[model samples]
Target: MSLLQTLPSLPSDAAYDLVVIGAGGAGLSAALHAAIDGAKVLVVERTAHVGGTTAWSAGTTWIPCTRHAKGVADEDSLERAARYLDRVVGDHADAALRRAFLAHGAEAVERFEQHSDVHYRPYALHPDYESDVDGSTLRGRALEPLPFDGRQLGALFGLLRPPIPEFTVLGGMMVDRTDINHLLSMGRSWPSLRHAVKIVARHAHDRLRHPRGTRLVMGNALVARLLHSLAQRPRVTLLMDTQMREIHVSDGHPGPGRSIEAVTLESAGTSRRIAVRGGLALASGGINRDPVWRERHLPGIPMDWCPGAPGHTGQAQALALQIGARHGQGAASPTFWAPVSRRQRADGSTAVFPHFVMDRAKPGMLTVNQAGRRYLNESMSYHRYGLAMQAEQCRSEAGEPGAAAALPSWIVCDAAALKRHGLGMVRPGGGGLAPFIADGYLRHGATLADLAHQLGMDAATLEATVATHNRHAEAGHDPDFQRGVTAYQRNIGDATWPGRNPNLGALTAGPYYAVQVVPGDIGAAVGLQTDDQARVLDAQGMPIGGLYAVGNDAQSIMGGTYPGPGITIGPGMVFGFLAARDAWRRCRSA
Candidate 1:
């Protein structure tokens, strides 16, 4: 059934204790938490589907010291995590907010696991991105959502925003890092073969009656669990295809007297004014979709480069600003980024695939600027790699030496690496190279000089870069940028590789291949300023009553720095939980 069919008509004058705008992970979490807390809640989603960009992500949550990480890393503690954050984040964000997240994050996770369908398990080997940072650990901080049986939602599964087709396999079967490993090793290992056969068979069965595979993992599982939990709450109403047209405050001006009073919502071309009793939680994906915010904050980036969902139009921020909500400052960057490659699919849609850990850092692979020169340590986190791209682009624009053309960098790799790790949209084993080449997505050449010509780079410079890299790679070292020295970097590299350094290998084999990568903002970091309790704040740092912001809608507590996996989703969920509980407390006092 469609989302509209599942939803009953709500009266124009209907009142709710809390109205959450945007149904991403944070919004859904807020609604679920509030409803569970005995407050009448209404969730408004701009699109027909729930789960914003979170559905497109890997769904790892980085919360230190949770019960899930208890036995895995007994040394982990709130104090240590705080110290790590203090060193990495510094004064980029409010210290109080960071402290609050650390203090209450475990409580929030405990609440959801006990009171709702949400569950998490710690990753045994997931390390903090800055492995060298003080108090960093090799495991137990990152949590992965348990795979969900979408069949539990039955027909409502259709309402969940489908995972990116490029991220799935066997047509529509969703797979995670573990699944990919199993699929890759199925040819040699009985256990892997069994796993692959079981998943493939399940997907085959699912296709008979469903639009996509029903065994959900990663972000889809997290959203599905939240949806199921919300469905069980009778006091919660979910409205899709709903737009918040306006927000009215208690007073006409921005001041201590100001508080969210009512909101105008439009659905199916009909506008209705509904009173709000407690607060409005803004969980819109971010300002990436809003032209004004995009231009003001992320000046030169194209909208097509952003991989987030379309629901984050900065509409909620604009509405809050009308009553004095101000954006936060002092962040390292305005957005979180990932280096992404684009490919045109047969369905006429462009697949903007994020090059996170698949190929860039693996042995026998390297990224270079248009000048055919290496610029950064290829084994760094995707966020830092993207920042490096931006830095290179800025240098090129500023006429820096040998950096004149660096915007759309290239990831060059040999046939051996391409067959093993794959290049953007192209699956491993190099099975279908013809289509990718014909579509101008993957560029290939018989040699370094030939590839340089194909990529419009200087032939001699390309050959020199490769020769120098090979000399170091043969010695199992990266002198220029120190690639793969850290635990985090090695973790992303090919651990099965026999090379002394998992990230270092000579790109000697031909035919060599290259894919174009551009900096893509995966999510926004600069957003509405809020206090520790998740209440939106004004220019004076005073809380705006009856208003809250979570997810990308709120200023990231990490100060725009990517600390570890699931930094975005983790804080979004923790603050969403906090916002709902705070609103409920306010409602009870009223």
Candidate 2:
């Protein structure tokens, strides 16, 4: 969107030392470190801009044994971290790659913070996904990108991708963990009110000169820092709207002797061929949007409900597959799971929002099936929650909860919850419900039975479900699902409460509310199989030279388990750096 954009023109025969096929966190980190290590790098992106899924993420990096990990009063060592992973990840994890990651992860974090525009701070309160597991802590081991001023990019600031409009406030103004707290506490606290006012005023001024707020935070800040760092490097060239059309393999695409020679690309409606001297780093998110690949990899899951970036059609993965690269199979999940809510916007387009860290674990709410029974603990992480949703669907196929209502189940809540926690698009304090209700994104009724009727569920069954739920919730214990019992459950639960239970409260006050809930994914879990150094492995179990993968483009190191808040972003960056490093080493050795 900036008028000061510039694209370098390469000669018809010119080639770079390295070509990174995606501009997300992994790709950008690969480019930066590769350039720093003295490799001439060129990044080509399919979309008109950079910052693939990283721009739309929480930007938390869950690396073990980093300095910031210690800064948060949490003790983390290589052995302890490996033990934790062994317990959680089990046999599916590749020991070699896991060891490589643990050894180099701290260096990756430290190097970027020291030499690049990137910096991070560990969470003082954020806990591990498996907080109860050995070597896990309640307040460390994850790093978040420090907030960056987008104004530093000058005219090119607009080029950095923006966050989802639903995740933002006041139209397009970006906010973070602290900003949300301030906004939530506004009207009750003077400091919070002033903080909100300052942000509003800043956004208003920003709107006068820009299309959206410029105070980037979270994932946007991380992308901006990586982009800024890339811009500062003279040897790196980033080409947007350039897509690799075809790749030429030296040995005709199969066997252990296969190697890449060059790739044909289409840029700005013109085709260009560039010889690849080192290798291609594939980090184009995953197969969340590729209909064909989705059917092959993650069958039966609706692609429209997912919250991944539209550019993540798995082009990179497909290209590797065309070159005889084997797709990793038998992983925990073919894709990372999440709970997503879809709402049709005013412009006749549907908006998909990921339920990352809001509203689920709050008090006075519960998830139920059509037969009207609580299925799983509602306070668990979104990924685990999706697995639970799938389990309930499988269970529904067998017996009792007849009609299999849990797959497309409903999140049942009360007026107190609507006024306190807000469900998806329905804002807190019961505001903005009419429009959402008009669009049928939200449903409400004077009683639990009426709400269930609106949801096509058995009224009597739902009434019984809520009654039983209310009794146990009021007692601060969940006899059926055991909600709010773990550190993770209580961590996401509401801290400001009057009773002993923070994640539980009686849903007795009318009117009751219900929202349609379905399982969705964040990224592809199973990806191109790769070696310890991030080299793409063929079906014969041989590493493919001149070909590497990172992020969701490569099989997950944790085997798709949601170990922490920033697991996706963490390995993406680490293996990305490793991909470039290995490629450079190979080229030098040759």
lDDT of each model, Cα atoms only?
Answer: 0.90, 0.82
Clashing residue pairs, candidate 2?
335-525
TM-score of each: 0.98, 0.96
Root-mean-square deviation per candidate = 1.5, 2.1
lDDT of 2 by residue, 1-590 (tens): 22222243676776777888888888999988898788888888888767887898888888888888776655668888888888878777687788889899999988898889999998778877787899776766778899998998986686788788888888799988789888889989999999999999999999999889988889999999998888877888777777888887886666668887788888667888888888888888877899887787666678887887778887778878887898876677777888778888878877887766667778888888767778788888899998888888877777753436576778878988888888876767787687888878888889887887798877887888788888887788887778888787888888887767788888878898888878888888888999888999988889887899898899898887888888888888889888888879867886
Instruction: State the displacement of the C-alpha of residue 132, model 1, in Å, after optimal TM-score superposition.
Output: 0.7
The CA root-mean-square deviation of candidate 1, after full C-alpha superposition on the true structure, stands at: 1.5
Clashes of 2: 1
Q: Which candidate is the best by lDDT?
A: 1
Positional deviation of 524 in candidate 2, in angstroms?
0.5
Residue by residue across 415-533, what tens digits does model 1's lDDT show? Answer: 99999999988899989899999989999999989999999989999999999999988888899999989999999999899988999889988999999999999999999999999
